[model samples]
Target: MSEETRDEPQEQSLFEAPPMAEQERMVEAILFATAEPVTIRELTGRMPHGSEPREALEHLRRRYEGRGVQVTRIGEAWAIRTAPDLGFLMRQEVVETRKLSRAAIETLAIIAYHQPVTRAEIEEIRGVGVSRGTIDQLIEMDWIRFGRRRMTPGRPVTFVVTETFLDHFALETARDLPGLSELRAAGLLDSRPPPGEGEEDAEGEEATDEGQEDLFEE
Candidate 1:
């Protein structure tokens, strides 16, 4: 009877995988509930002490590889997002070329024109909130960079257009920006001012700009 029970145990161990299914479920739940990219520190916090979700995530990622969505890591963060090829299905439109939103375009223009300008200035011009992703998108596109500090009260970090931005836009320098007249000719800007009291202030000769000139020479 003892020998028979031993044989039965070995047979069950060979064929059964009960614990892995549970691990997979937990990992899937973590990724689903997390809107921001999640990291190992975060997952371990919610998991039983010393449990290996990293190994399990690798397994799940392999299963998802070459499929609709993918599991990817950005810096220290991990996220499951739509695969590039299938992103079109999630949208309502037919997905013509993506154009920047009015706020984004306005932000880009300010950064291009006034650059090394502060976020406060960008916000002041657009009259709206700005998200990190907005900055990230511009960074990912290599169109902007963190620029020299303003010698203001807060010593805020400012943004400046990258060489890539100038290259892409075919401008010799920041000074070449279409001017009110040229932007109108290119149909890139209408007569309406960008916004705010500072909008008028930005197009003027300021001491801050004098410092930025040597910094962004391209």
Candidate 2:
């Protein structure tokens, strides 16, 4: 072999990924195109083999700081969303005029407050049977999803609030949710005594069964 060949450096491939700034742009594009929050692993799967998506994401997130739109992390996923302070600008565009039925509202509250909860547990809390339509509606809305099944006799499937639910409420996690007193003040919870409370009172009023209906009405 020639001495010149031995001294020569390896040629860089033309197809090599661009610089980190460019990679940040790629990450931004992918995040913008995706409807749901994406994980670092997912980003890596879609990006070039040698690309550093995590670093790119960090750069992108910093670049978006104080902008009208910001990059946010929900659990293990990342998403581009409106800046919290400027969210009012888009409120008119995203307002949901339709109201959820009382049953659906109550069910959602129960699931949010006690996640990984089973149907029986929710029924036990609300003092009424949870209808199929209610659970189906929450699932259809993508606010709540099926979680792992319990280890008990029936091995019943559990329910949990989705990231969408947290985002809708502008919460980073379930722990950010308001306390029970705050919920009552916001009219999200009823003032009535909780289920199983009157069972021990000999003179307590009988518990009434509130009929469960469709998740939404009108």
Q: By lDDT, who's the top model here? A: 2
Q: What's the lDDT for residue 64 in model 2?
A: 90
Give all candidates' CA lDDT scores: 0.62, 0.74
In model 2, the clashing pairs are none
> What lDDT does model 1 reach?
0.62
* Alpha-carbon lDDT of model 2: 0.74
What's the CA error at residue 30 for candidate 2, in Å? 1.1
Worst 10 residues of 2 by lDDT: 209-218
**Best-matching candidate per TM-score:** 2
User: 1-218 in candidate 2: lDDT tens per residue?
Assistant: 99999999988656887799888988999999997889999999998767899999999999999999988887678999988787657756843444444566767877877898998998888777777887888899888999999999989999999998776655678766644444343344456546665321122223322322222121
Q: In candidate 1, which residue pairs clash?
A: none
